[model samples]
Target chain A: MQRSPDDLTLSGDEQIAGEADRPFARSLPWLLLVGGLVGFAAAFTLTVEKIALLRDPDYVPTCSINPILSCGSVMRTPQAEVFGFPNPLIGVAAFAALAAIGAAMLAGARPRPWFWAGLQAGVTFGVVFVHWLIWQSLYVIGALCPYCMVVWVVTILLFWYVTLVNLGRTRAGRLLAEYHAVALTAWFLLIIGLITVRFWDYWSSLI
Target chain B: MAFKSPQNTTASGARAKIDAARAQDRRRAARKRNMTIVASLVAAFAVIVAVFLAVDPGSGPDGDTLAAGESRYVRSDSHRLTTAADGKVTLVEFLDFECEACRGMYPLVESLRKEYEGRVTFVVRYFPLPGHFNAERAARAVEAAAQQDKFEIMYQRMYQTQTEWGEKRTPADEYFRGLAQGLGMDMAAWQKAYEDPATLARVKKDVADGQALGVQGTPTFYLNGTLVQVQMQDDLKKAIDAALAG
Candidate 1:
């Protein structure tokens, strides 16, 4: 009655009940792989732009399309370097690690429960930090960076899935997981709707 | 070793049945939970839609209403930097050309114009302060430019070259005329318009209107006839956006 090394069932009771039958158990690896890679690329691009701006003070970022959607404005803000270093550096490291972990999981690495808990902690922190950044971009900074937005999307998706997977043992969590697609769509709609409404004037000018 | 004892085999079969029953019960529970979540989501969405339709913001009390007869926000003769097609949202800035703060705000306003281009109606009004020696002269110069369809050009030029002629005790009338020359305006017409008493009166009219509206400083902005207290550069843009949203 011994489980194999990679079985991620949280407890023996759930394992006995075959908790690994969930679809997320199979799909999450791929999600992490793709989400992590996309986030990594965005963060990497932002880091490059920040470095270029530092090298030449007059550098206009490629994402500086207009005043409202200007990366140049967002990058120049103190919040861009909240930890006394560029925030994208954290993104670069964290996303790369997530991608590596996803690759390992795809290769049948059933990490210890401690590892999953640690990852949950990391993603929770990422989600909170990203939301703070979103607020800063929308209200305080009054600008949006395209690459930063990409990171925001990936981070939110990753956080939701990871939390669902970790809380799989709970009945409410399982219920939420069943409606993940609906929940994700609603979540994204809320954010995108806010963006559209907040900058309606600037957006309408394009039309 | 194929040592299948009869009693042991029966116990394993019964355990298998129990496990299957537990799984089926779990799935039934999950299905009920799913239904509950979906039903609640639908109910929440319906409530949201109902609340949205119920709240008629136009009929609500507007805190930023202008007093009666304070139509000085935009006159027919007011110069527009950009006009919206719907004419729904108008942003008026009472600016003094020679004021240092107005010069500092120049780029921010220009960027806002670009961002809100056709979605906002941007109007300019002269509120030349008495402190600066060249304030009145600059307003008169710009007003004169308006006569020749060069109001926008002169308006831009004044801010672009504010440092050169601003804060000077002597008359920068010559400097403003130089800007007019740079713009290739007809010198005779420019001189006449610049010196016209009527042009000065036009500038004074705006100043008087701004005073009546409580515009005590340069770079005062009004979004849809309500004065905007802009403590930050983005406040002007934010106010216009809120008006447009409304």
Candidate 2:
């Protein structure tokens, strides 16, 4: 008996999902792996060295040249503490969670609904923190924390990736598909340019 | 022939059910998206509240004087010199007499003193930035007035009429004479005090004290003994609340 296109159906044995799912699932693994590695390394380095460097006055190991570029000057000030605690502790916990998330993604595990929600929460936190740190560095402390700045960059990238992936899985997939790559690249360049302009004086002084 | 017709009918029925299921899935996804947007907005609001609570612990029962201790001053001397008595919150200002920023901050300082009254004390210190040529001489003229208990009047008048006296048009001695007349100082005593080398040394000492406490620029204020780096009103309030709590 002949069948129409609407009526036709593959047998259970012949059914297979498309390559679209395969690529989409695999993309996350690479992102998580790289993000995890970078986050772990950056967090570990800052946690170990930056805190110790702050407590010691005579142990300046370069990087403290101009008044504005001086990490020692900024770190020594009371503005470094938001709630009587160093903000980098938040960074350590956040990066650690990101690394765990990345590992889970690498294992081919589909995140539960709560996992996506948690990720969205984290990205929001990161966005707030990055802007706060930038404001403090620019107008308040008038000096940048070198290692903390690196963490800020990585956190922003990780946030962008998480947002894109979440958007792709949800009903807003079309919006994500249209602007994800362009938005990410544009943001990356904008931040890099801002940092460059901020330290222009230090660069010129060296030259 | 009858079985063939029934089979076609069943096939069409199954196809219709499948289409309906897909449509339902699309509606469910849309609902989920709407829910997520609502949840995200709620979460954003919660975060803002949390941040506010985290930054400002609130003003306790101690009132404005306790709150004033947390305000950012330009330098520690501004606080130390301004406090009328031990345990009192003070707003100390270390200023260059010729600094434009200092001139601007003068009225704000005056208003704060009036507003806070006995709860806070306002102390003025000389911190002439080396870049301004006339700042040192201007600082000395104010110190000379302070010898006769007219420093505050002269200090305010110098800033009020900063354009006439602070810039290069008028000579330092001539400006001092003008300030003395405006403040109703005894001219003979004012002239003798203005020329006193000791008065200049006292102004120099205030500048030295400001530098020792990390005063980087003019119009620096010290709330209590802590060096304030930011000048925003909310930040100042937050610091004051924290100090009051302490």
Candidate 3:
């Protein structure tokens, strides 16, 4: 069913109008395409590694560098399977959906407001879940998994921009859209600082 | 008082209608703009990540960082495996006496020390974790043993009897004293050293050095200047062999 363009949520600013429309509209699909690929690769590899460990208990994950930086330690923890299945499995499905949605949008599919809303909800869960995983990794698990860190980085970026775009029609989103990079940089620095502090022993030692 | 013709009134009405028609295009235009901004945001983030990786000091595969220097590695000088520090290779271990992993790798390390006795200068540094009840005390006891030139004897003693007092909450000071007595160590001197603040200071310094070198857990080893990222015994051996070869 075709609706008027105004009916679609996440379609951004009215003031710029025809002057800036077509070029910007064409770039969303590419945005999703890049984020989805990196995120998918990280999840896919983690799942494969987990499966390998399960198949052979003696198998050491390639990412297990030491006691402080070990993927194998993270994978064995119960939190890695919070939903009674490996968390990376969820990442696989979500990233695929993200890529598909991006491709469709690129192909001129104008998803209803509900689709954007659902994506917002999903990524909200993702951002929260990943932060919790970061906490568990640093405070509880006492190790950093390389692939999982990649997922964490992408998930934060995905959630931030997703929320920004989804609120495209709102005054708040528009204002935020102006300083999008600043907010993202703040979020990145916070996480990076936390990681640096938590593994200070390891990080400082590197230098 | 100015006369308004029907033509003027009709023109005004048409202008309002045109404005109303333009309103319908606003949402489409808004979505287009938002998408573009979102896309640019993602692209910017990707660029940031790219820049970070480019400048990342530890840029090897699997996030393997470059090794720290050897200038500040040692503090206590008594716990070397070889008498002379003239060996081509210097292997440093940050160990906790009460750790199971340390206990597990003890025999392997002992054999490796024997195997590379002359070629490698093995240095042991105390890095007792807070969780282990007797680890710090054990380190002090070893330092005390070093006073009598019996550091290796105490080292072998603690690991050998790790099962008896390793994870126990009760202090193993009495058990350690018995071993020291059996080895003919002067009980008074060893006791005084155990209580010496200097003994604890030595452990703390080693712990700090280990942290500075990014060592988080016990039994962290460095082959020459590089941290040995060992998953198995062979990994340590391979690193050591490479250093020895070089």
Candidate 4:
């Protein structure tokens, strides 16, 4: 590892090049592969279920477990097809690409600057879109879709990791990398708290 | 082997001392970095949670009010559970008779209408979803009953016996006709009106009006012309009480 002379810290010990290829760092590619695959499968299933719903007006989706968690209720609304087509079409394409990229990373492909930038952009859009959906689900349309929630979780993790990788050698990014799990744990807790509080009545009844 | 010579041993000893010093330095740097990162991350997490809580929809009193058009929602011929001549608050409900959710809210609304009998004018507008088999015909039955001045009676009976006839996925016209006779309605007149375009038109008009008002589901409530976010009974009661107070 090469150290920059001007980048010396207060302790004056070499902080090194912060090269991300440490032996333990190899596990990140594997995590991405698994997360991407699960997300792709979920998005694909939601799209297929959407087609089934279109074919039959009375079709109750597999994800329609209850009133609170029904894809059927969500699908009938305009928000489900915001772009004049089902939103899952975008998901199916995006997640499939995400899974393919994850597989390439697992195969030891060191992506270039443009590749990392592309991943960052894709995930940034996904995070924003999912946040909007979370707001809509809790406030506007007033329902939750199970497959959509799966996509939301995976997308969040994917975005977080992608961002960490894109930050390169910055001090902030290095700090983030060292405590990646801590950041992820906080994010998960925040979202879970939001959902629990939003549907407190229904959730409390289950117990 | 090189250290076997005295000259090389001196060099090797100096190198060993330097390597030990570097190792100690690296360990200290690692400790410092790890601690700083953890502290920074915890602080970042706390700040994020605080900011989110400040703007969270869960904590905000952001009401989901519908922009109902300029027209007053209630038609002169619309169904009324309680008709108060000078009632200040009008609770408009867009409902489907066969919807299970409507059935669930039936007793609740019924009790409220009775409790606030003279204070509120409770109106029901037809909004029969295509999926429900008996919803449209039930609307017609209610309309047919309305012709004989027994709208309230038939409304109660239909809801009271909803489970017996609802969600059958088959026509329940004959059963509804039986209900009309039981309600002491003019059976012949009710039968003619059942097939009359005017009665069907009456029901369809209410549905069209509901659609115009942006009603997309059963049991959608418009209290005093604003959509009330029905999270709890207290929330709804508060809206009604506000409307009545005004």
Give the candidate number with the greatest TM-score. 1
Q: Write the per-residue lDDT of candidate 4 for residues B93-141, one digit (tens) a residue.
A: 9888888888888888887888888888898888889899889889889
| True-vs-predicted CA distance for residue A183, candidate 3, Å | 0.6
Clash pairs (backbone) in predicted model 4: none
DockQ of 1: 0.17
| TM score of chain A per candidate | 0.90, 0.74, 0.86, 0.86
Error of 2 at A13 (Å): 21
- For residues A32-88, what per-residue lDDT tens digits would candidate 1 score against the true structure? 999999999999999999999999765779998755667877898899999999999
**lDDT at B209, model 3:** 69
Q: 1 or 2, which is superior by DockQ? A: 1
Off by over 4 Å in 3: A1-25, B1-246
- What is the iRMS for every candidate structure? 14.0, 20.0, 12.9, 14.2
Collision count for each candidate, in order: 0, 8, 11, 0
* Weakest ten-residue segment in model 1 chain B by summed lDDT: B56-65
* Model 4 residue A183 CA deviation in Å: 1.5
lDDT of 3 by residue, B28-84 (tens): 665566667656766775576556545664432112343443344553352786632
Prediction 2 TM-score vs. true: 0.40
User: Candidate 1 chain A: minimum summed lDDT over ten consecutive residues — where?
Assistant: A1-10
* Winner by DockQ between candidate 4 and candidate 1: 1
The order of the candidates by lDDT, greatest first, is 1, 3, 4, 2
Q: Could you say which candidate leads in lDDT?
A: 1
Which 10-residue span in candidate 3 chain B carries the lowest summed lDDT? B58-67
Residue B124: error of model 3 in Å?
Answer: 5.2
Residues A36-78 of candidate 3: C-alpha lDDT, one tens digit per residue:
8889999999999999999976467999775566787789889
Against the native complex, each candidate's DockQ, computed on alpha carbons, is: 0.17, 0.03, 0.05, 0.08
